[model samples]
Target chain A: MNIILVGLNHKTAPVEIREKFSFPEASIGTFLTQLVTSPLISEGLILSTCNRVEIYAITENAPECFDYLSRFIYENQKYHDNISFDQLTRHLYFYSSTDAVSHIFRVSSSLDSMVVGETQISGQIKEAFDYAMINKATGVILNKLFKKAISVAKRIRSQTKISENSVSVSYAAVGLAKKIFGDLTGKTVLLVGAGEMAELAARNLVNNGVKNVLVTNRNYQRAVELAREFNGISVKFDEIGVELAEADIVICSTGAPYYVINSDMVENAVGRRKNRPIFLVDISVPRNIDPKINTLGNVFLYDIDDLQAVVEANLKERQKEAEKAELIIAEEVETMDRWLKSLNVVPTIIAIREKVEAIRKSEVDKTISKWQRELSEEEVGAIENLSQNIINKILHFPLSALKAEAHLSGGSEVIETTRKLFDLAEEKQPSQDPEAPPAGTAESPEEPISRSRDSRENQ
Target chain B: MEILLYKLPLLFYFAGTVVYLLFFSIKKDSLSNIALGVTGIGFLFHTFILILRTVESGHLPLSNLSGALSFFSWGMILTYLVLEYWYRIHILGSFILPLAFLSLLSAAAFPNEIRSLQPDLNSSWFGIHTTLTVLGAVAFTIAFVAGMMYLIQEKLLKSKRFNRLYYKLPSLDLLDHLNQWSISVGFPLLTLGILAGALWAGDVWGAYWVWDPQRIFTSVTWLFYLGMIHGRLTVGWRGRKAAYLAIIGFMGVVFTFFIVNLLVEGPHRFI
Candidate 1:
């Protein structure tokens, strides 16, 4: 059997095309059932997200399965859009065997994501796999493949910093605040003006457990509206200095061309606050906070460009880590390939023959050694010939029948029966049962995935 | 010879320090754990050497400059291990492991001969004085490390120059907390160690008060940290000011440990 993936992602297809082909979660079970109905496909899974729609399958004939799935999805999309089959097929990308396995692993690891380090794709992949599992659309091969994909994704996450850095400018501001304050709890965030970027950052801070949010704007009504939205009090513009002293974080984005928060003002605030550290982010285009305020002890100031620079640097760091993640995925794909290769009839047949040959040799030697009188050379040779002939005669019909059955699609069931009949499981395969679900990925799947997704969304 | 046993830990410390510095630059989590494991092994070997020396000499191994420096490093690593276990602050090891290694290296440069203890040094009060004082120095070393991290992180934030260290270093709040904790713990140990040393002087030299350079410098270091504690508690002198004071207090420790011990002759001199 071979693994195959057929899909179109945000990179390969436009959103309109992707959306037309994308399967809704509620109807994916019917699609998966339709997917497994093909004679070539033994197992199937459909991963449908806003960014991409992919169909993964285990099949005996990869080329036939690929063609069948393309037509299947094309037919499914015909009901939704008037797009021609050629137009849809032009955007589709297909991977077969090892490439297919590697593709899914990379997809699950988020290396193939729109945002390369995004964590959403992994959960969506798991949800897709779980849906296929509950619908019984997946069998042993796809089960092992998806579980390994999940485990590989987990491994990559633990081993690399791909998902550790924030990519968005507003989230980067939150990340910087964390590096300064360690924890945002009980820290007060003061917004100098009710700008979009400043409001987004304040929302992030509040989500991260920043207890108090104070908004002060040149327009007092706007300040009160923004403060009410944050469940915080609005400070008068004249009290900005006093509020700055109380706030551990200050986000400034007023439209004033000159420095609204000057060095002297920050110095006085620092003195009043008794040298407690404060983080200031100025997301204004023309700059609001004094650059020299950064020179004062315990004060950190970053303007809009500075925040963008931070986001870019973090993206660059993630790109570097993505290379390491690729190496890890390569290693896991090789392991999975070995496991897949072992499922073939050739290896199991050789293993069974080896087991029987060893047993026959040991038993014949034991019987020969039991003689009280030493046998002649001819007699020993005759005994060896008899034992070999007898075993060959016994194994001939079964081995030939196994080989004959290997050409048919029902070969896996026969192979499994032969292994059990011969007890070939004792011969040290990579895994005893690839069908068994991985313990680490099985337990608490929904809680951790949703919780992590929630946290990332908050950021 | 005991020299081989003493030098073995030096090599391990050098390896540990190199690994920690690599971890600092590479920012790999496994490398930090490996660095900790390497340093832990070095600490164990150093402990064995000290225990062997103590058994061989029938006293604590702080009677000579060589033994005292080695003991100082052991205490520092022990304290660092405790802090790391509690906080998992791997970046601190990058700063601290080099200091610990250099102390052992300098200890190896001195004579390895375990001489018979001087009459004045042959007392339990001498042991208590040395242990407490070395431990206090260890706490100051940690404070010094946290302070350096605080300044580096602050510089990174102020200049808007992002680097791996910027992300790896603990937050200013956490580093400042570490600084506060170390100073708080170090000051009292140092005071008690100084008192014990005075008491030992009274027993040996018939005077509790001496104008020894080591004693005067240690008193000055103690006063600096005491003032820091006072300022932080009373007026909230924290963050950069506390970081600077911690760094300065460690320099005082270095001056007393190296300069006063080498330059001046006093009752406290054991080298």
Candidate 2:
């Protein structure tokens, strides 16, 4: 069988095209059920997220499976009249076997994400795999492939610093606060304005374990509204200096024309607070906090430009780490590719031998039953032995060739050609044997293709 | 056998220091653990050497400069291991192990031949004094390392330069806390050590007070740590000011340990 992937991502399609193809989370089970019912696909999984939608499937013919899956994706979304099949095909990309395995690994590791080192994509991929598993849409091949992809993603996360730094402005501010305060457990944060950025920073701080939040704005009603959202108390804007003396962290994003927090004001606050360190993040267009405040001892101040600079610098660091992640993904892909090739080779070899052996046994029985006179038991045994010897002699060279080809690179093509020469494809319809145990799971060299009902039921 | 024990630890300590430095640059988890394991082995060998020396001399191994230096290195490693276990500060080894390795290296320069203790100089006070003083020095060394870490982390935050080291180093708050813990603990041990030395002096020289350079320098080092402890407790001096005091107080310790022993003549120099 062949493993194939067909999908369109943010790079290949715009948000409009991507959203059109996204499967609703609740209906994913129905979608996967319908997907695996197709004659071309034996095993299947669908990863549907806002940025991309991808389908991974196993089939006997890669070309036919890719066509069937792409068309299926189009039919699922045919209600959208704005786009046609031509437009979708222009955006869709396809990969088979090793390339397909490598693509899934990259996608799972977030190396192919819109934000290169994002942490959400791996979790999303895991959810999709779990959903497919619960829906009974994934057999051994897709199951093994998806499990390996998840592990590779986890390995990359631990081995490299890809997800170490914050990429957003609010998160960068929180990161700086952590570096200064060590732990935010009992620290107090003062929100100095009603700007959206300040609210985001405040929310991030609360999530990080900051216990008390003080919200103050020139418009007292807005301050009360924001404070209630944080489960904190509201203070008048005039009392900011008093709050600053008590606050370990302050986020200022007011739309004032001049500096709201001056050097003299911070200097006074520093003395009142016993020279304890305080962090200030001013994320306003027109500067709200005095730049001169940073020069004072035990005061840390970051304006909008500084926070953005931190975010950009962190993004660059993640890009550097992404190169290392790619190396890890490449090594894992090679390992998975080798196992897939072995799985293909072993099953085909078994199927071809079983086909020829069945033919030999039936022919010998027919000749015996057609006899006009009764034969001795020794005569019957001699005829069976003669047929078995002929079958072994004729099968030795081809079976030996198949076993030898299993050891070479790109050996699956040779195995496929051998299967076709013996007409082995039509013998075992993949979905017809719904109770057949998955092949090559144990990876035992001796009993590679043997299956029992117990094994299938256990799976 | 004693010589073999002494020399084996030097190589192990050198290896440990190299690995720690490599871990500092690479920031790999496995490398740090390997470094810790190497350093722990070195500490074991060092403990054996000190025990053997004490057995041969029939007293604590603090009578000569070589023995004193070896004991100091052993104490530093012990303190480092304890702090590492408690704080999980893996990078602290990168700063602390080099000093330990250098102490052992310099100890090799002094004569290590064991001699019977002098009757006039020998007393139970000698052992107590030396042990307390060396333990105090170990604490100061840790304080010094923590101070340096605090300054670097502080500078990175103030300048907004989030480099690799910036991410690797712990927060200023943690480094400051380490500084406080070390200095506060070191001050009392140092005071007791000085008191024990005076008691030993009274029994040996018939005078509790001495004008010797070693005595004067030890008192000076003791005063430096006293100021550090007093400043932190009363005035709430912390962060940058506290880190500066820890660094400066440790310099006083180094002067008392090295300068008085080598250049200045004193009764305490028994090598």
Candidate 3:
């Protein structure tokens, strides 16, 4: 069975939808059992960290299994039946077959995680996979995929400084603010929409020693919930302008159709706030705050795109590690491919034996008729023995070639072509379709996964 | 046994310094460990050499120009190891290693007199006086190195040069703490050392105080460090200004050790 991972992540799913679909720590075992029990699924593992929920399955139809997982998680599944493809499809990413394998390698390696080059997610992915293994829910395919991902993660860590710095947008916004104000202890934070992205920004601001956080949301209860968690006060949604006036840092992540913080409201806030330099971050999709807010004096407004430059520089630093990580992945994949290809041994030996026996029988019959009148019975017996020796000698070269090819993978081009020319193609006697379950992961050849586990576990 | 106890250390010192200098040019942090290791091995040999010399001479290795100077230099090298181990201040090594080499060179230049204790030096206070002053001088040299690094670091920080020194020097706050911390300890120890010297003078020379050039210069170094320490804590002096003052204080101590001993014709004369 081939390894496959298919699902949406922070990059593919909207904040609201992703939040609704996220799995808690308590439900992983049940989810794993459900995923593995599917008709097409051979073995499966689920990696459901905050940023992603990827279902890695060894299966014939990954799309069906992946879709089933999504449907199970999406609480309001009925609404999706009427929704346009663009509405749902834009936010759902899919990778098929080997591409699915590569994507999972990248994800479990944290190369695709929202915070590029983060090391935390790899360990968490391994923990998820190991838990599945202990339950016997994960078999060979998942074992290789998960273990390969861990090796890639390690190669990246040793080779690069990807995790050396905080290059996330939330952090960049705070860093830019620090450069502007030189200090953030007395700053005011005004958050829009109690969205998860908004909460992360709030937490970053609070970490920089923010004194007060003024929160607003269309849902007052959500605002109250966010404010209580962050030790802040909730204001009426209509009072955003007045609240904006009192704040030094404003982050608008409502993902509203129209601008929530309009130019006029910002202009008034600028005047009311007395021209103090304010930092605003718009993390909303579809653009919550107007782009024109950046034109205001003493106001530094950054959209999500603005954060890409910071992440780009950090990505360069992490690229060094990514190369090493990818090399490790390519090596592991080739080894696994070799094992999968080697399972053709049974068919190869059967075909070789049948061809040699037919050649011996034909030569024996032809010689027996010619010598019937002139030779003694003992002479005919000697001819039969000589014919058997010739056949036995002929089979040696092909049998050795087949044996060598079986230990490795696909037969030699010269040997296989010769076998076919000599009428030796019917292998394994066509016995019941030679149905072999996908090649099993007999403990990884070079031992990267076991090495890492031993290092951590023994310690 | 004699080679291990004596000449081998001098060879290790020369070899260790070369390795560190090469590492400084090549920008290798690992080589810093090699330098430290080689020098650490030299330090072990030097300790045995000093003890053997002291035992053979029936002295504490504090007598004569060569022995006193060698002991003082060894003290500098020992301080370097402590700082490197405790603070992991790799930047300090570039400055510290040279001072040690220079002190050892000066010690080599001096004649080893092996003079038996005279009545003036035989008093109960002589060992206390010389030991305390040498201890104070060691602290002074360490402070001076920190101050010098601080000056270079301040320029780099101000110019926004994020080089090796910028990254490796302890934080500005930490450097400031160390410079003042060394001075705070050094000045009072120097003061006590000088006070004991004067007390010994009263017992042997019939005066508790004298205006001898060596004594005056040594006392002057103590006061300079004292002033710097006081200025830093109370007046909030820092960065380059504090660094320069530390440099000045160390110059006085070095002057007392080298110039005053060579040129002056008082009780603390080298020639």
Candidate 4:
């Protein structure tokens, strides 16, 4: 079987078109069920997020599978009259076999994310795979593929510094606060204005477990509105001093022409706070908080430019780490590619073993029935074991050669010639048993092939 | 065998220093962990060397220059290990382990031959005095390290460079807090140590107060640290200014421990 992926991501399609093709989480199971109903797709999974819509499948024929899946997508969506199927096809990207595996690996490892090192895609892919497995839409190929993808993502996450720092302004603010306070739990955040940036910082602080959020604006109504949205309390503008004294962190993003928080106010607040450190984030254009306050003991002031600098620096660091992550992905893809190619030889090996074993059993039965004297059960069992062992020993070298050749560039032709020479395709129906031993099963006659596969996986 | 044990720790410390320096330059976090492991093993060997010397010489092994240097390095490592454990800041090891290795390396440069204890150094009060003094000096060394980190972090934040080292170093608040705590804990122990040393001096030379250069320098170091603690407590002098004073006080400690003993030829020259 071949692995295939067809999708349109943020790079290929705008949000308008991507959203139109996204599969809802609740309907994914039904959608997958409908997808695998086609004989072309043996196993299937659908990954639909705000940024992309992708379908991954295992199929016997790549072109047939791609055609069916694309048609399925086209027919399922209510297209605009001005839009044509050709235009839609232009937006879709297709990868087959090894490229398909690499695409999925990169996507799952967050390398293909809109934000290069973002972590959300890995979880989304895992959820999609789980949904497919629950709906019985996946089998051995997809199971192994997804397992390897998730593990590759985990390895990249741990072995590299890809996700070490925040690359956004609000998150960088919270990160700096955490650096100062160690933990944000039970800490108080004071929002000096009801501007969007201040609210965003407050929201991020709340998400990081800051206990109390106090908002203050020149207009009380706006402060109350912002406070209610964050489940916080609103204070009058005159009470900024008291709030600043009580707050461990202060986010200022007002549109005032002058510094709203002067040195005297902050100095008084610092004295009242018993010299506990205060983190002041002034994310305003003209700078809302006085720069002189940074000179005060136990006070740290960062303006809008400073936070943006942190974000930029963190993004650069992440870019460097992304380089390492790409290297890891490349190595992992090579290993997975080897394993996938080796899978092509598995059916041939199983078919040849069955053919030989069948011949041995039939010959042994004929020999036993024609015996002159009645043989005991032990003697009959010994003969059966002897014939089985002889068949296994004779088949070992050819199976090893086929397994070793599977990883080479032209190895599939060799496998095809062997199958034709032995007439192995005639016995393919028996070899298609769902209850047949899996590729890595211990009891199979192709044990060495499976063992080498296992070793590759461990690496 | 004892000599080999002492030399073995020097090699371990050197290895740890190299690993920690690599961690600093390359930003590989696992190298810091390896550095910690190597340092921990080296600390074990250091402790064994001290114990063996103490038992073999029937003294606390704080008489000569090598012994004093080894004791001082041991105290620094012990304090650093506790702080590293409590703070869980592996990067600090990149700063501290090298200092520790250098101390031990310098000690190894001196003769480590065990000698019989001088009769004047046989009193238990002498051991207590020297141990407390070394512990106090170690605390100041910790403060020095934390202060240096604070200054570096402060400069990074002030200039808004935010380079690779800026990411690897600890926060300014944490470094300042450590500096303050080391001074607070080290001051009282140093006071007691000075008193004990004064008493030992009176017993040895019939003078409770000596105007020797080492004594004066140590007293000056103590007073500087006291000023730092007082400033932090009363006037809220912290951050950059406080960090500068801590660094200066550590310089005083080095002058008192090394210069006054080796160059000035004071009454405390046994160290």
Candidate 5:
């Protein structure tokens, strides 16, 4: 069996095309059920997010699987009239076998994300896998592939510093506030304007557990609307000084050509604050708060450029850490590849062991029956145990050599040679009984080996 | 055996200092915990030595340079551990543990032979004065470390170039707060120590005020910290200015504690 992935990410396709292929969460179950109906696809999953749409599958025929999936996506979106098959194929990128496994690993690890080290893509992939599992659209191969991918992503997150620091402007603003106040639990935030940037900063702060939000804008109705969204209070823009005194943090983002908050106003507010520190975030283009306010006691004012500088610094740090994360992913991919190859030799090893055991059992029975003197059951048992130990010791070296060679490149050649030398294939068919275990029984040593081989031949 | 016990603290502290410096260079946070554990063990051994010395001499062992340095190093480690527990600033150990180690190593350079307590140093006031003064010096040492951190962080912020070291260092606000706290706590203890010394002087030397260089310089150091505290409270002096004052005040502490004892001959020269 082979692993295959066909999808278009932010790098390959524009948002317009990506959106056309996205599967809504409510419809993903039905979509996955429809996808695995083809005989080529044994298991499947679909990851749909704003930045990318991916389909991961375990299949017998990788080329046919790729064609069917791309056609499926094109038709499911009802785009036959708007786009041609060749155009849709141009937008989709396909990977087969180990490359497909590596692609999913990088995607779940966020190394393939548009943001490089984003955390949201891992969760989205997990949700997609869980949905596939619930709909019975996934089986053994896809299950192991996703589990390994998730663990690789987890290792990358913990062992590297890629996701430790904030890399966004709004997050940096919140980080500065945390450094100043230590804890923002009961602090009040006063929003000076209703701009998008100011709302984003307020939202970040609120998420950090700042419960009291005071909104003040030139437009009173907009202020009330913004305040109502956060379940906060609305104040007048004219009363900025009063609110500034009451707030531990003030977010200023207005379109005023001049400074909305000057040094003198901050000086007075600082006096009233009784030495408590205040954080001021000025996210305006023309600069709403005076830069001189930073020099005042008990007041920390950061302008847009300063916030951007912090974000840039953090991004550089993450980039340095990404190099290390890549090394870790490379090692994990090698390990997973070795494990997948090692699965191929299990049936041969078990077949050889069973063949040797059968020969030893028949020879021991003939020796016991042909003995001249009538021997006791204990003497026969000792002879049988002695013969079994010799057979095991004789088979140990070749068995270990075969298992070791299975992990190297061109390992299937060794397995084929061993099967032919032992004539194990002819022996395997005649020994099969109606009462024997199923093909992929968990208790049997040859289950996954035979199952995987059957799927490969079925292609 | 006693000499070996005295030297063991120096060895442990040196090891801790090496580990801490390695941590600083490598940016590995786990090394900091190992450094803290090593330093804590060194501190326990130093405490054991002090207790042994005090039991052997029938007095607090603050009468010689070796005793004073050991006690001073112990006080600094105690203060550092407390601050580390409260602030959770692991990187501070990288800067402070070497000072602690060097102090103990210097103490080892002096003879470990216990001398008889001098007559003038036998008073209860002598013990109180020396112990309190050493604690005050430890606080100033902490302030010095925090001040150094503040300056580095300030430089990074001003230049807008943040390296790995910049992230490892504590924030400016936290460093400044530590500086202020150390000064606020150190100043009062130092003032009381000086008052106790004056009373002890009057009893031993038949003079409440003396023109001895040690006496004069201790008073100078006391007055400087007093001015710092007054400025901080009244004029809202903080951040860069406060950091500078804390650093300068530690210099005063070192001068009064070490230089005066060695160079200046006065009634307080029992060591």
Candidate 6:
């Protein structure tokens, strides 16, 4: 059983369809336990976000097991229509084995997410895996695969400049404020209007260590609720000019059709503030902070469109920056592929060599035992030395041939043919010594046998 | 004798110029180093010929028109090589190669022979004056190159088209500082050179100043560069303004170099 990610995401399904299949936080433990208990399923994780719900699982008949997975989810969630087989049919993505492993990795790393390079997916993917691990629902393949994917995501982020330099102008405004003052600590922030977007930005500001948060909205209760949640003060929407004089950073996101803060008012406020740098974040529809306010001294006023475009432009450039990261990934992928291909040669070579060495070892031990009664210790040791030299001299050529073909095309077939011809599989250990020399060390270079011995042993 | 003494070196300078341009196009560091070494050796031989002319004539070689031009251009090459080594700026070669070859061509092609050596022009103070003035012109020529490169680099950086050759340029901050320093240093040297020339003129011709075409153009150069240094120091005039001033200063130099001397009948018309 290997990686098989099944289910729907934003690309294929609507919210209604996804909701039916989504994993609620409360049910994930039970969900993953049931998934693992299925004889076909070895390990599984449920990545549930609002946009999509995908199941990363280890199962052999990845395509065949869809009915069981969908039925279980439909019965448990009790959401409308409950994502049936026909609905799940088109939206589901099944990655068998390696493709499945790489898919989960890309998803967890956020490489496959709707928003490329978003930091949220990695955390959510981790939560799902942690839930699975808690229930004893993981195996070697899933564990290594998920862990490697997580690290790959981390590598893509830190090594590439894609995540650097904030894209959002809301972030940029906050960024400039930090650049000027070194830290946002002890700085009072006044967010104008309790619009949903403004509230979100305000929360982000508080998260980033703003000392004070003040909210102002036309609706008093909205401001009060936002302020109370963020441990902040609420102000009347009309008193924004007074609030502006106090705020070191102002975020204005109002849905008003007309301008809120006029240039003349800002100009007067600048005079009262004694020319201190007043950061104005205007996330308004038509515009809240007056465009003329920019002409006022020391007032940096950026509107909603400006911040979004800045973030959008930043994301576009990040896509460009991702070009370099793509190069690094391609290099790593090629390297991993080569190493994976090389692993195929390892088992065959080891098995064939073990056979020849066993035969030589057996001949040495048998000859030693045959003379054990008549010979002195020196006589016995000398015959043992002769047998080893003869075996090594006999096996050298075929050993080199097997190793030479190890990396070539049709190399494995030649190795297999050599194995079958020599009947090396039959030369499995006889009366095994508890400890034997490691493979490379075990081969005797001084003996210089033809690789024919290995070929013959394989046959 | 003229071809051996002048044309031979110009050929070497021209060939060295081509090699250096090739060296940069390919980005072969060793080839560039070799180009510098070849040009340096050519300058050495050029220097030897100047010394030989001095020893034969019992006067500093710049007593005549062609001699002065050769000494002035030589100063440009020698200073460039010295600063290149000091700064390790291989890209500057891409700028200086054209100037070096052209100046050498001017020196080689000038018809200034030992035209009945004006005994009055051969004074010790005149030698000192001419040397300082010529050296000052050479220093400004180097500054002019730096200014042009600064403008190009600033444009490329601002456009955000930072390509391979863009990285090869000195940083904008570095080019700005160097551009200012070169103008600052060159301005004062031009001033002293003009002052020395006046002193020597008075000693020889019983007049401290004569508004000859050459002298007029030289004064114009001094004024333009002085304006630049003042603009940069006081007005914080930078970037395009500084670049324009430097170009103006070099134009005066060119007028003094080829045009004024050839077109107008002046004391320096021996060319």
Evaluated with TM-score, which candidate comes out highest?
2
True contacts kept of 6: 0.00
Q: What is the per-residue lDDT of model 5 for residues B153-245, given as tens digits with 9 covering 90 to 100? A: 766655555676777887677888888988888988888888888888777877778898888888898899889888878866677778888
Candidate 1 residue runs with Cα over 4 Å from true position = A78-82, A346-389, A392-459, B26-30
Error of 1 at A273 (Å): 1.0
Q: Which residue pairs does candidate 2 place in steric collision?
A: none
DockQ of 5: 0.30
Interface RMSD of 2: 1.0
* Separate DockQ for every predicted complex: 0.69, 0.64, 0.03, 0.46, 0.30, 0.04
Candidate 6 structure quality by residue, lDDT tens digits, A116-235: 667788777777778878887877656766666677778888876556546655465554455334456777889888777777777667777788989888999999998998899999
| Candidate 5 C-alpha lDDT tens digits along A46-83 | 88888877788876455556778888878766454677
Q: What is candidate 3's lDDT per residue for A338-377, written digit by digit as tens?
A: 5543534445556667766777788788888877899898
Order the candidate numbers by TM-score, best to worst.
Answer: 2, 4, 1, 5, 3, 6
lDDT of 1 by residue, B92-200 (tens): 8898899999998999888868898877557678889888998899899889999999989988888888888887888889999999999999999999999998888
Candidate 2 per-residue lDDT, tens place, A1-459, comes to: 667778888887778788888889999999999999988878999999998888999876555667788887887783677888877777788777667888999999898888877889989999999999999999988999999998999999999889888889988988898888889998999999989889998888899999999999999999999999999999999888878999999999888898989998899888877768999999987989989999898899999888988898888888888888899988998888777767767777678778888998888889888882687888989998988898889988988887777656646556756877998754444443433212322222222121111222321
Predicted candidate 6 versus true structure: per-residue lDDT over B1-271, tens digit per residue:
7557666667677877888788657644467777787788778888888787788777777755678777876787888888887888887877777687787677767665655467786556766777777777777777777778767764543333434455456744455556677777777777777787787777778899887778877877777777777766665556545666677788888888678777898677665
lDDT of 1 by residue, A1-459 (tens): 567778878777777788788898888888888788877677999999998888888765555566787888787783555789777777778776667888899999999887878999889988999999988999988999999999999999998989998999998988899889999999999999999989999998899989999999999999999999999999999899888899999999999998888888888888888888888999887988878878788888888888899998898889989999999999998788666655666777788789999998998789789962688878888989998898899989898888776545445566767888987653422233443212111111121111111212221
Tens-place lDDT per residue, model 2, B92-134, is: 9999899999998988989878877778888889999998988
TM-score of each: 0.84, 0.86, 0.56, 0.85, 0.80, 0.52
Give interface RMSD, per candidate: 0.9, 1.0, 11.5, 2.9, 3.5, 9.9
Locate the minimum summed-lDDT window of 10 residues in model 6 chain A: A436-445
lDDT of 4 at A218: 94
lDDT of 4 at A173: 87
